[model samples]
Target: MEVVVNRQDRRKRRLVRLFLRLLLISLVFAAACAVGLLSYTKMQGPPPLNVTQTTVYYGADQSIIGEHHQGENRHWLPISSIDTEVIEATLAVEDRKFYSHFGFDPTRIGAAVLANLKTGSKSQGASTITQQYARNLYLSHDKTWKRKWNELLYSLRLEMNYDKDQILEGYLNTVYYGHGAYGIEAAAQHYFGKTAEQLNLAEASMLAGIPKGPSYYSPLFDLERAKKRQGVVLQSMVATGYLNQIEADEAHLEELTFVQNELDQPSTIGPYFQDTVEKELIQTIGIDQALFEAGGLKIYTTLDPQMQKEAEKWVASEMPDSELQTALVAIDPRTGDVKALVGGKDYTESPYNRATEAKRQPGSSFKPFLYYAALENGYTAATTLLSEETTFTIDEGRGSWSPSNFNDNYADDFITLLQATAFSDNIYAVKTHLLLGTDKLVEVAERVGVESKLKNHPSLALGTSGVSPFEMARAYSAFANGGKRVEPRLIRKIVDSEGEVLFEAEPEMTQVLDPKLAFIMTDLMTGMFDPYLNAHTSVTGGSVSHLVSRPIAGKSGSTSSDSWMVGFTPQLVTSVWVGYDKGNLQKPAEGQIAKRIWAQFTEGALKGQLKKEFPVPAGVVGVKMNPENGLLATEDCPTHRVSYFVEGTEPTKPCPPPAADGQPETEVIDEATKEKENLINRLFRWLGN
Candidate 1:
C-alpha cells in the first residue's frame, strides 16, 4: 500500500510539470503576436479622405446656369456643430459601447461570431464605430477578407491617432445619406431646410435614422419607411438614456418638416444642358470624380441664354408629345462654343438628355464625310458617277447590301457629285464610298469630330451608323469653320470653393480638312437650297429657303426611323434630329420634322445677327465647265455650270460638239451653195469616167 501511494505522487508531479511547460510556451507566442500586431497598426497611420466638392456652373454671360455635385454632397462639421441627440442616437444604433472599446469590442465580436455560426452566414454585425470610420474614410465597402484585414489595421491606427470625439466627428461627417447628401450638415440642409446646429430633436433623430440605409429611409422617396426607421431611432435614444419615455413618445409624434421652399435644383432654363454638363464635367475633360461629387465649385459654361430660349420655344411649340421627339444643338463653328442645346421635347416629362446621350442614324446627313473623303482622294464637284440601282456583296455570309434612296428614285442618268449631294442620292454616295474606300470615309468622320464609333462597311456611307445630334453639329462645324475640327465646348472654366482654378478651357482647333475643300463643300451644299440652280431636281430644303437670311450650307438625312437637317453658317452651326423614342419614324407633316425645327431656330436665333457668308479662301480655281462632261464649256455645250476646282484638279480640255453638227461653230455652209457645188462635182466626175 505504501509503494502504490509513492508511485501515484510521482505520476502527479510529472503531469503538473508538463502542463506548466506548455503554458509558458503559449504565453511567449501570444506576447510575440501582440507585439507584431502593434507594429503593423503603427504603420497604417491616419485615414485619408478625398472628397468631391459641389460645383456651380455659370453661362458665358455670367448667369447662374447650373449647380451640381462633384461626387458626394458633404460638409465637414465639428462635434459641437452637430446636435447632441443626433450623436447619441447614432451611438445607440451603431455602437453601444463605442466610448469604452479600444477600436474593437472583443465581447461583441465573440457574440457576433457565435450568432453568425448559428445562422451559417457572416451577417451578424461586429464592426465598431472606429472600424466603420476607417472603412468609410480609407477603404471601399467590400466584404472580402483582404478588405476586412485592412479595415482592422486602419481602425487600430485611427484609434491610436484620433480621440473618440474626433473619430465620431469624422464618421458622422463622411457617412452617405442618399440623394447626393453626405454628412450631418448636408443631411440637415437636404432633409429639413435647416443647418446642422439648428436641427430640432425630432429632425436630428430622423436624420440619424437615415444613415443606416439612406435610400430605404429617404423621406422624399419612402415616407412610411422613413417614419418607421425614425421610431426605431427614438426607441434607441430612450434605451440609451438620451431621451426619457415621455420625451421619446413626444419626439415620435412631432411633425417633421422637409424641404419646403425652392430646393436649389438645376433651373428650368436648361435642365438637359445642365445635366449634360455635369456628366461631361467628369467624362470628357477628365476631372477627378471626387471633385465633381464634392460640390462647391464655380464653373463658367458656353451657353447663350437668348439662343437657348429660342431653342426651347421652337422645340416646345413644334414638337408636342403627340408628335415625334426632337433634339437640337447649336454651336459656334469657329470657337466650338455650344450656344444652345435641347435634348428632348419636355424635360419635365423626361429628364433624359437626348442631345448628348442618344445615338440615332443620321442617314444622308452622314454623306458629307463620304463626299469629303472623295474630295480628299482627288474627286471634284463636277466628277460624274452613275446613280443607277446597284448592289454589293458583303463578307462572312451576311449576303449583299442594297441601299436605297429616300424615295428609291434612282437617277439612271449621269449625276454630278454636287447635284447628287443636293438630292441626297444614295447610289451616288455608296459608289463614291466604295471608290474612296470605306476606311478612308471613317477616318474623315473621326477627324471631323464624329465621336461615336463608326461602322467600317459600305453602307456606313449612307449614314447607317447611329450618332448624337451634338456629333452631327460638331462634324458640320468643320465645313462652316474653314475645315478646323473643333469639339463642342460645354464648360468654359471651373474654379473650386477655395478660389483655386481647377480647369480652364478654350477651343482647341485642328485643321482636319483643307480650306479649299471646305469652301467647295459649302458651294456644293447650295444645290440642296437652290432649285432654280439645279433644274429643280436638288431642291431638298428649298421650303426654308425664304427663312434663311445668311449664306448657309448643310445636308439633310432621312432614314425610316430618323430624320436630320444639319446646316451651318460661317458664324454659327446647328443640327436638328427628329424621331420617335420607340417605333420607327413616319414622315412628318409639311416637311421633315428636322427641317421645321432648323428653320424655326434659324429664324429666331439669327434674327438680330448680321448675314454671314462663307469666306472664299485661297488655293481654289473657279471655271465655267460643261456639267455634262466635266470639261471646259463651249457656247453651245449641252450644259453650262461654273464649277470650282481644287487647283491643278480642274478639267483642262474644252467640250467638243457631237459629230452630227459636222462643223465647228466658226465655219458655216449655206444650203443653196452646197446644192450647186454638189451638181458641178457630179458632172465633172461623169466626164472623167
Candidate 2:
C-alpha cells in the first residue's frame, strides 16, 4: 500500500510540472499580444500632415524662370492617391503575400529560412507589405536580429490598425528610390517625366525593380540591367497572379520606350544662375529641410530656353579642338537675370564650373575698365596722348622692370584716345594706365563688377588681372544698362513645400558711372567698327555693327593663352572664354573659333527680335569728327566720321595746330591719294606697304 502511494505522488508531481509549463507558455503569448496591441495603437495615433508642393516657372516664353517651394519638414502624399499599376507591380515584386497576411506570413518565413539554409547564405526576405511599411516608416534598414524583431512587431501593429491598402499606400509614399528621389510621385517625375497615372506597365515594372537597388537598376546607368530586372518583376507578377502569363509575356517583350522628355527639354536654367538663387534662398528664407529633401520642385527660371540652347550648341560646335574647355555666360542686362550659361564641355568630365568659379587672366578684356577709368577721370574721346615711343621702369626689389608693346614699333605720334582704343594698341593703353594711376583703375573695375583680385601694375591695363566670365558680364552690364550696375541673380523667389514665399530676389541697381560717361564710352566702342577708324587692319566690326540688325557694344580680349569676347545689347550681356584647362598658350586660329561661336549664337538668338539700338538718353547727341584727329568735322567730313557724345561734350572746335618742330607725321589723306603714295613709297623704299 505504501509503494502504491509513492507512485501516485510521483504521478501527481509530473502532472503539476506539465500544467505549469502550459501556463507559462500562455502567459508569454498573452504578453506578446499586449505588446503588439500597444505598438499598433501608438503607430495609428495620428495621421500625417501633407507637405507643401513647389512649382517652378519659366520665362515670358515659357522657358524655366525659377522654382518655388512651400511647406514645413515633410513632403508627403498618400499612397492610394498614386496610380494603381505602380502599387500592383511593387507588391508583386517586393512582397507577394502582402494582401492575405495579417502581419507576417509563417509559411513565407519558413520558406525563406529553408531557402537560406539550402543556399548557405541569407538572401531571402519574408517581410509582408505591412512589415515593409513598418520597417520603412519606423525602423532603419540595418540588417540585424534586434531590428528585425522590432520590424516584425511593428508590422503586426500596422496590420492590426490599418487596412492592406492603407499600409501599401503609406509604404509606397515613404520609400526611398535613390538619386535624392523620395516617394513614387517624385520618382515618377524624375525618371520618366510622367506622373504615376501615366506610367505604362513596362514603366511600372521598371520602377518596381528600382527599390531593390536604385543605383544598380537605374536606366541611365545601364538599360540592359534595368531591363533584366524588369523581366524578373514581370515574371514575379505572373507567378503571383497579379498578371497572367500572356500579360507577362507582353510586358517582357515590350521595348522600354523611356521618353526622356525632361532631359531633352531645357528644363533647368543656367547652372550658375541656379546656384546663385539657391544661395540667396538659403540666406533669405532659410532652407526647409523637408522640402529640400523630398519635395519635387518645379523651378521657373528667367532663362530663355531657346537662347540658352543656341548658346550651348554654338560653344560646343565652334570651340577649338585644342581647347578642351570653355565657358559662356549670358544675362538680361535690364533685369540682371542670367539667361544662359555653359560652365564646361561636359559635367561628367569636369564639374569645375569655369563660368563663375575660374579666375584667370582677362588679357585685353581689362582694357575696357581702364578706358572707363580714364573717362571717369576727365579723359574724353578727344583727349590726345603721345603714342610715340615710351618706357617705364619699376624696382622689383632685385631688378628693374620694363614693358613693351607686342610689335615694339612705337612711333612718336599723337593719337586721339578714341583711335588708340579702337585699335586695342598695347603701348598706348599702358601709357594711359601710367598716367591714370593703377589705384584709380582698380576702383573703377571694382565698382563696375570685377569681383576677382586685381594686381596693381601696368599689366593691369592689358588685362593681366584675373577675373571670371560672370564678373566680366556684370561689368559689361554697366554699359548696357546705361551705367547702372545690376547685380547678377539666378533665382527670383523661393517658396517652401507649402507654397509660402520664403524669399524673393529684389532687383538692385546702382549707378556705377555717370550717364554721360557711359554714353561716351559706348560711342567710342561703337566706332571700333568704323572702317575709317580701323583702316589697314582686319579687326571684326565693332560690337554694334557686328550685330548691325540691332545696337550693341562689346570688347574682345586675348591673353597669351586665353581668348575672351564680352558683348551686350541693351537687353543682354554675354561673355565667352576659350583656352586650355591648363592655361597653355593657344594659337590665333584657335582663338577665332570662340569668336565664331559668339557670332553664330548672337545671330540665331536675335533672329526675329525687334532691331533696337541701345537707347541714348535725351542728353546724348551725335557728332561728326575726323577719324584721324578726333576733332570737330566740317560739313565736308566723310560719312564714316560720325560719332556720339554727351550734348555738352560734343566736339565744338577744330583740331589744334601741329607742333612747330619739323617732326615726321603720318599724313591722313583720301584713300585714293594714300594708295598712290603707298605705291610710290613701296617702289622707292623697296619695303612692303
Candidate 3:
C-alpha cells in the first residue's frame, strides 16, 4: 500500500513539472518572436511622410508672385521652428500620452471601443498622434478594420524608426486644416496672414481646434462654432498641464482677427509668367513631376513685377476694342531672362499663353534673322537690292513667285540694306533671301536659338514662317546680347523643402554671331526708327518714332493675319504680337496697333531705366553714306546717316556731286515731288527747313 501511494505521488509530481516546462517554453518562444519582429521593423528606415505642400514662386525682387499646390496648401517646418504653444495645443487635443505611448494609446482605445459599442455606432476616435500621422501619410481615413490594421502597422514602423519629436513634426506638417490649408504653417499663413512663428497663444488655440472638424470649427467658416471648439482645445491644454485654467480663460476671451476668406484672395500676379515658369521648371529644367506633386518648393524666377504690371497696363490700355488679341514678352537682353509676359487680354477669360505658345507669321519682324545670314555672308548695311515690282523665276517645278511691298509701294531704284529694312520692303527682302540660299537663313535662325522649324522658301525672308513671340524674343536676344546665344530662362534657381538645391540657372551662352556683324545688324535695325532711311515709303516704325525717348532699335511687321513689333535696347528685348485667335485678316488700322502697344509698353516698362544704346563692336566702323545709293556721302547729298559695316564692307565709291547741276541727281528727300509722302517725309522736310 505504501509503495502504491508513493508511486502515485511521484507520477503526479512529474506530470505537474512537465506542464510547467511546456508553458515556460511557449512563453519564451513568443517573447523571442516579438523581439525578432520589432528588430525587423526597426531595420526598415523611417517611412516617407508623403506630405503635399505649397510651392511659392518668388520674383526677381524676392516678392511672392505666385503659389502652386495640389489639393492641399501645405508648408512644412521643422519641429524647432514651430511655436511651443502650437505644439502644446496640438498634443493636448490630439494625444496627451504621445511621448509615453509606443504608437497607440491602449487606455484611450479601450474607452473609445466601449463608448462606440454601447452607442451602436463607430463615431468615437482613439487614434494617437502617431497613428493619425501614419493614416495621413500612407493610409486613408476610413473606419474599416482593414484600414485601422494598416494604420497600426504603419504607426509602429514610424515610431520604431523615428524619434518622438520627428513623428510629432511630421504630424504637425501633414495634418489638414480648413480652406485648402494643410499643416500649421500654411494654416497660420491662410488664417492669420502671418507665419507660424508669429502666431499668438489665442491664434494657436484657434488653429489647433480646426482639425477636429475643419468645416465646423474653422474661424473663417463660423465664429461661434470656432470659439466653442477653441474653448475645448484650451480646456484640454489646461488638463494636460500645458496651460493654467486662468490662462485658458484669458485666451478664450482674446479677440482673433481672421484673414479674408480664401475665395476672396486675389489672383496671383503674373499668371502667364507664372505658368511659363512652371512649364520651364518641368520641361526645360527637367524637374521630376513627383517633386512638384510633393510640393514645398521655392522657385526663384526672373520676373520683374513692376515691368509685368507695366506690360499688363499698356496691353489693356492700348489694345484696340476690336477682336484683336495680343501677346507680349519682355526679356533681359544680356541674360535671356524673361522679365515680363502678357499672354492675353484677360487671363481669367482665356489662359492661352500666346507669348510662349501661340505661333504666328511674324512678317518682317523675322527679317533680322534673314539679315543676320546676309551679314555673315559678307552683306553689309550698305549692300543694295532693287525694290521694284518683279517676279523671280524659281526651279522649273515650283514656278515663279512675285513679292510686293506694303500698299504696293516701292523704291523703284536700288535701296541700301538700311533703307530696305526701315521700309520693310518685300521685294528687296525676297531678292536678299534668294541671294543667300534659303538653307543659309534656316541655319542662321537655328544658330541664334530660333527653335521653330522654318520652311526653307523665298518668302521666309519676308517673314512668312510661323513662330512664337518667345522664339522671336530669344532669336533677337543674340543680336541684343552681343551675338551670344542665350537660352531664355524664367527660373533662376529652385530649392526643395529640405533646402536642397534642385536647379540653378547658369546663364548658358554661346557666341553664335560675329560681334561686328551683330553690331552692324543692330545698327541696321535702328534704321526703322531713323527718318534718314526714308525714301519711297515711311520707315515702318515712323508712326511711333516720336515716342522714342532714347535710342531704340526695332522693326514693325504685318501679314494679312498677324502684326508684330519686335525691338530691343541694350538692356531689354521685347516682342509684341497682335492678331485674331483664328486666322482672320487684320484691318488696315489694326496693323498699326502692334507698334503703338510696343512703343507704349517699352516706354512705360523702361521708365526709370537708363537709356541704353547698342554698343558698336571693335571690328565694326560707322561711315556716313547716301541712304538711297549705298555710296559714300558727298558734299551735295541731301540725306545721310551713319551706316555700320565690317571694316572691309564699307563702300568705296562716293556719290557724284549734283549730277553736274545745282539740282541733286538722286531723289534722297523728294517730299515736294512725291504725293504719297508719309510721316517720315514730313519729319525730314521739317528738319530740312
Best by TM-score: 3
TM of each candidate vs. truth = 0.60, 0.72, 0.85
TM-score of 2: 0.72
Model 3 collision count: 0
When summed lDDT is taken over every stretch of 10 residues in candidate 2, the lowest stretch is: 680-689
The runs of at least 3 residues in candidate 2 whose Cα sits more than 4 Å from the true structure, single-residue gaps closed, are 1-32, 35-81, 84-126, 137-147, 156-169, 174-183, 186-192, 200-256, 260-305, 392-412, 495-502, 536-549, 581-586, 654-689
By lDDT: ranked, best first? 3, 1, 2
Model 1, 525-619: lDDT tens per residue? 86688665454254688878777767778888887788899998888889999888776875556237688789779878888888877788887
Order candidates by TM-score, high to low. 3, 2, 1
RMSD of 1: 13.9
Cα lDDT over the full model 1: 0.80
Q: Which candidate comes out best when scored by lDDT?
A: 3
